[model samples]
Target: MSIAAGGFTVMEAEDDYVEYVPVAKRRALEAQKILQRKGKSSSLEEDPEKAKLAEAKPSLLVKATQLKRDQPEISPTEQMVQQEKEMIEHLSDRKTLMSVRELAKGITYSEPLLTGWKPPLPIRRMSRKQCDLIRKQWHIIVDGEDILPPIKNFKDMRFPDPILKMLKAKGIVQPTPIQVQGLPVVLAGRDMIGIAFTGSGKTLVFVLPMIMVALQEEMMMPIAHGEGPFGLIVCPSRELARQTYEVIEQFLVPMREAGYPELRALLCIGGVDMRSQVEVVRKGVHIVVATPGRLKDMLAKKKMNLDNCRYLTLDEADRLVDLGFEDDIREVFDHFKAQRQTLLFSATMPTKIQNFARSALVKPITVNVGRAGAANLDVIQEVEYVKQEAKIVYLLECLQKTPPPVLIFCENKADVDDIHEYLLLKGVEAVAIHGGKDQEEREYAISSFKAGKKDVLVATDVASKGLDFPDIQHVINYDMPAEIENYVHRIGRTGRCGKTGIATTFINKNQSETTLLDLKHLLQEAKQRIPPVLAELNDPMEDIEAIASASGVKGCAYCGGLGHRIRDCPKLEHQKSMQIASSRRDYFGSGGYRGEI
Candidate 1:
């Protein structure tokens, strides 16, 4: 049988339709028939005690009124006690109890400030002319109030005696431009965003401040088990995290030998046994250097936390954002239980990164050693127009241009392997690293190259972002990267510590015209000798300056690519389409509209 209801048809068996009755009505009809046939009392009627009890029960409104009258008024103190009891019960979990105990201990403990520690004196005390001259001499551009004077030497900063000795031991007698100005801002407890050339001692700018913060916290109140990470340094890659961890460890050794409070630093990164990291965290860590993925995992799994983390540093900030770690970074921020001194250090400050900084950092002072994205003046840049087929053959000649400890960056892992094997066949001491390699292999390659045991290290852009090889004499770009920002970082691997180095790049027809244009501009800006091929390609946007003036923006504001204006940016368009596709997919998947109209 078929029947129609609303706009759809319904089919049922013939007997089902005839015999079906509403359940409520059927129950009532059966009760009536039972009364008629056997004259039996209903269950509720037969239970006299239950019926009487039901009659005695008051209505909800009456009961609520009675409850209000029966309860005694609680004093504010008694209410607070109740609240405390409830909170303690809620936080009875082991992890939360540990956090509470550490917080209580931190609040109760007190100690004198370390000897020789003093607040940084303001630069305003100096004559205006002297201050101007000092900034000009160091090429330091600072944007913030009451900026501290640049330190002439390590002593001017008033570092502890052990730190001074350690500095001298490492042959670092004077502060670099960024360090001179940056150290004071961070030590003063102000947030900062530091921009400088890749090899301009940017690491020390944050690393030293991190050590100082961790040391102060430890002295004031040592962290208990499962209760720290007083200072946190988040890097974008495992190699950078390892390097930063090592720098912190090196600084800690001197303080330990000087009989200071014992402080522990932990390296949390992927491709290592998580059990080991958990074990270290359970013991307690004063400082943590980590990449985003493993750090997020540890935080999510309740193995570690940032309840006491008072200092946060994002090294290679631009690279982190570019590599799509921004969400992970924000998620990590959610784990922080209090305000922290945030420091963002990077070689390039693109518009996207600048926006991210404004949103993430609080009233940060920006210190720029040179114009953002500018090439290092200390490096001699050479560009060659070589055919794609002949590029591999010319690699041998390029290797001879520099001494041992040279870095070669390729765009692809397969190319890195090819070049590495080719160099080995020709009896060159070379090592290669890329994402394809395991952690142990990558670490060995980097360590061997840094130790000068390997004459050349070939790798992808993974090595280019923020890996510091202080003795590297040359950097060769096996292929120009897709973005101009990457090209800047690639060449910056050399020419560190005020020492001059060389950068060589090979270009061919396979490269894009936009990239060639950006390279031309960069070479022109750096005053390097431009190859004939790059010199001939004219920028099609002749009215770029006028357009920028009208729009109140300069360059490609989207991706910060210098090759094209915003309207012509391929990356911008690609990102826009991707966003649209993602939104559409989300909409359809969310069941917004799936059926035909």
Candidate 2:
């Protein structure tokens, strides 16, 4: 007997009993038959009524219609106009949202995607209102063809997300005016000269750009330790360099990760072990913050090269020049490639600085935070005409009334030591530093002062510039500097970061006579109150305008005298003779004064 399957037959066993197939095999055979039927079903003719019924069946989706159609039978033209109005309103909302997002991200909108829609204008479209705003709000001066990009906040500057996160963590939410205006100029690959008060966030102006440039370069071509650093920041002092290095490291935290190649910044300053610096530098560095002396030494010793340096910045540039590093600065500049970007920052723009800038920078954008040589208005300054012998007593009295974190500046190392010893003897914790001290000693003194382990710091002019101690309540000029510029820097040590501070200067006729006229002018310019003696000593001839007005003659502006043009002024001739005599005196003094009595 045989059991018939679909197009096949299964014969029974020889015992005449039925032999069942496995369950799986039976199901497989059934599936094959179903697939055959399905394949052949299309070819076989179907009923037209069934096809019509299948086609008539609809999905669960409902047809769309106007919701208010039941209310009224409106004209087609009116409906078209209403729909157009609604579409326009929707488009306007979308455009507004897009504009806000772009503005926040410091991005300009692209051309419109739709046929009828127009692209929004730039939010920073430099209008007359914005120009007036900048002029009125800041003492910004632009010399190049490019207009500065205005920033209302850090968000408007469009810093990287990592940087922004770091800034937020550091509690820095807004960009200072200088940072806002100057960072854009630096990032634009142009040389810039930034003049702002000491605590106006000038460090970050170049720091942000340096980090951004490094990150961008790293992404494109991985930075290697062998090729040298991509950024070089030159500061006037070792402490300033170290401070800048710390700030860079703080900003670099988010860029370096656990498993990634580290982004390194090295401080190649003196006082530290050179071998350790050389070792780390051999490994690689993305940035280098260094002093002129140490950096020049490294360059001479062939430890570093500037061929790969794309960005160079000078902090406290005027001080650097005043420190007599002009030749060294020029030598370092020679090492850099011509295509490198140079940025200079100073508290004041003097003739020497202007000349150096003209030679060193290429079409630099000048960013002045306040007046070019203006002092911090936040500082309350007073002058005391103490006799030279009475300064210590006066200083002791001032210290009795003032708070800690006070900085005392002297003229020489001996004065620094004397003041420090005097303060120590008087039961005041004090530390002193000067150029004469060893590097380790200077470092210890500064560290002690910064850690609040010492209440007072006595130092020469070496400590006057670029050392940022945040909570200094007072700056005491134990001995006034001969140049008024140095005086400006000295007093600036106290009033920083918008904090109210007091600066007291000890002035006397014998010691401060050379600077008395200039000091009076500076104090007046800063709007500080003068003592009776200082006010009495004010030179009438110093004010060219006042003297000229009083003289009632349109005399030479240079000399402020009658019957002399600027070119033919007797004072000019006298000044020329004095300069010649001074140069001769210097020459003879250096030559041991051959014919001196």
Candidate 3:
């Protein structure tokens, strides 16, 4: 039985339709058409006008069938139409406003997005309130320039003699601001919380202190029992731990050759040879850089001990929470007993982290190198509002302009893969990395990117934290992250270590109002001027003074006082008023009598 045109079921004699399925003629027709499109012959192709006949044929068994005939002659115009259809399908994958330069096998050039689509404008601007705060900094910068380190002088900090010598030989004279403020306290064994944007030389702040401690320990004490790592550095992910480990390794080598060195270390991360890690641990390493999970696993099995854990560092503390490794963090903290000095560094510190901070540290000195998620002043932030359809087109244009190293942030793993594949098909060099990618592969892609081998990297939030690719110039939000906090880490990839960088976000009308508002809040808090288009978009801060004054809001909790807070209250103000009242009473012979000194 066959379904002719106009939905008629034609039941053919079994003998006549011997080669066809007995009752699946309808299913077979469309299937056959596709096969013919691929240049393969099908039973239905033999009957050129059979589909149009609209005649029913009886079902048949053991029916003999004719082979398909050639397709109708295609006109040049029809061929053009077919070619265009294919192109449209290809272009569908490469949307406008999304410049997808995937970093796979070196970025391949994909034809940019549709013509005539304008690059998007930024979604929102920094608020006016934030703008005012920024202007104040310039004044302070000028006034303080004389008393503070010059920009170049930052690198020439008065580090300790040995550390200074090591830095000079390594050509690392100037300290990044994070290093400037953070290193001192960290080296002092003061538990510190470091909050700086990504790429702000935050690693060095902790690394320098770690080295100093390691050196001090080397000088004062003999090697500890077991291959237990003396210094424990924990991160959220394997890639980050490895990345940090490698970076610290470079600085450590020079120090090792020069002074109290011999700093053996164990890498305890998942997805590697466990026995090998254990062997290294058995050999007594100086530092153990690890992901929380593998470290916890080893500790649970009693594989290592922190009997000598003197210095502890948690990198990307916020990311550790995000990765659902909060328990592991607690365990890592619990594992290290005694009065070990600890350091926790994160790009942003939410309330939850503050809770963790309260539990982990002993009256730690807090250090905020930058506002949480604030755009680095050194980085240029460009906003472009683009429609999803036009995003790929804008991306292509953006890519053509600057082939600089770029970190592309996608909202999800699926999007990362889809965008990565589409860019690849479009001949754009790119690779997709999510939590899904194997650790080694992720490392390879990141390493390739950092080495200046890959032009673009498509990643999820994992790469947004603790990534130290200082040369990254453009951070393109192929899609805005749902969480505004992630936005801070994303742009932070560039403009790090005090280098100028650029961040461009593509927005469309469909861009969430809430997202733009949050972004505006973030940028404004960072002290950037709001884009004119979004000037009115910012919600004005409520006039809180009236509310404050009506209830004596400024009164100190410690003392029932007006015109002053108890803690920092000026005694002279009350004393001066009392004198005035007393003088008036004396002149009038009234009850008031106190006088100023």
Candidate 4:
């Protein structure tokens, strides 16, 4: 019934147009300010007398001199741009993302205030060669020598032939831990809750099973053609939805090629054309991938129907919980039939989500491959203490020296822009991804980055979970995370699949007081070397890197101490968490009926 055995899938994406919503709006004002700054620089060059007077001022003289030392040799205007960017950073509250972008787009010395019109941005894409070159550089940096864990093959697993075909085409010969443990439960028509780290191939886990159900339906009604998907995939961000959509499309290719390929796909996300999206739904799609808010709009307009949905996959389930999508998610679940299959995937399971998962799944199976609350030690952690203004310089210098395929994680979207624009001005190959971008542009940014067209990706919490970047060599925490758990997941991007990677974080003086305390505790537990500032308040260190080493040492193969390997241990290896959680339903839904086999 499905071409999954061949690997191409019918997928979805925002068609094209994007709207300018305030929260999701691009900083047109900021972009205009930068342009004005440029114009001012030109004026300075044109007027020698004015330039001489400007440099004569004591404040300006010291700044120009500092800029000369801190930044790479560039034109005078470029220098001004760098200095202005630094000044603006101090003025931001660090509370909101849009504000950060506005701050980043500040004017040069020429234009004092941020008022002016900037042209609308046009679509842009990178050449394949440029992207391919970046992709190829990854193997050199990632470490996978100890990564010989057996690939989980569920060939004994039962599924429709269509799925088999799709897998063959996509080259997914084996299931990852997430796919292997989670799929069969779902295939048996049961709900599932999966908790694992990033880069664990979480996407394929639920995607393949949904494809199978679609395939099975096609077989029952051989000539039914594309009645479309019996599934809905709700994601946290547009970029992730687009990424998932593209991957799904790849799986749908053979179906389209085999005929009866009118399998429709629709995308509903903020900052994009809603009416057009509604039209696509009216035209009919087999599946819908969306952010919660946009879907609310679609449902309000009567353009989407969840009444027929028999299955749902929640990606980044924890993040969705964090983003306050509970009510929307509940609304989505309420629209589904009582016999629906719900699959929830997350990197870490907070108790709040555990309760929600229990409520949603009917006797669901819980799979834990990496163990409970375990940090993936594959990524090497590195740290530096510096002034807030120095961060712009530190990041640029770091990239120049160890520049490899890298992902930069920021505490917030504003910080994402701060790092993103700093890199752009320095001519570093980078792009930013956050909820702020319209759905289409977000998708484009991810595609371009994955294609290896980009060297560095500056992202906020958006990229912190449920993402895969197989060749990433480095993950930089531009600022330390407020939550210890986020730190565990953010750096995990690098050391995936047993590959060795590195993570670097910058801790500045102006960090929020509460966040700094939490960060200090986390670094201490990790057993990393804490800076001298905290030495007096800290306990005596048995090890040199007292602060960061506490949680970092690989549990003793013997005594479970970090310093010693298991080779010297006298005890046998022991397993941690149970492989599954007993998924028992509390009570049957009123007037519910079992699904037909």
TM-score of each: 0.76, 0.71, 0.63, 0.60
- Weakest 10 consecutive residues of candidate 4 by summed lDDT: 139-148
**Once model 4 is optimally superposed onto the true structure by TM-score, how far is the C-alpha of residue 176 displaced, in angstroms?**
1.9
Candidate 4 residue spans exceeding 4 A from truth: 1-151, 159-171, 222-229, 258-262, 439-441, 509-597
Cα TM-score of candidate 4 = 0.60
Q: Which of the numbered candidates is closest to the native, going by highest TM-score?
A: 1
Model 2 lDDT per residue over 352-391, tens place:
3554565445566787777555677888988888998888
RMSD of each: 18.3, 33.5, 30.3, 32.2
Better of 2 and 4 by TM-score: 2
Decreasing lDDT order of the candidates = 1, 2, 3, 4
Q: Model 4, residue 158: what's the lDDT?
A: 50
Give the residue spans of candidate 3 off by over 4 A: 1-166, 169-171, 509-511, 525-597
Which residue pairs does candidate 2 place in steric collision? 225-284
lDDT of all predictions: 0.79, 0.70, 0.62, 0.60
- Model 1, 326: alpha-carbon shift in Å? 1.2
Give lDDT tens digits, candidate 1, residues 1-597.
688999899877565457669999999999999786564235548889866776698679989999999999975545544553343233232112112433455532122112234444654366767866988999999987656666677776767888899989988988888987888778777778899988888888888877888787787888788989988999988998998889888888988999988889999998899999999999989889999889888999999999898888889887886665766777787787766778888888865566556544556788999878888998999999889999999999998997788888999999999999999999999999998899899999999988988899999988888888977888999898877888898889888877899999989988888878878878887899988888788876453555555544455655556667655666545556765876898978864322100
Report the Cα lDDT for candidate 1: 0.79
Q: What global local distance difference test value does model 3 have?
A: 0.62
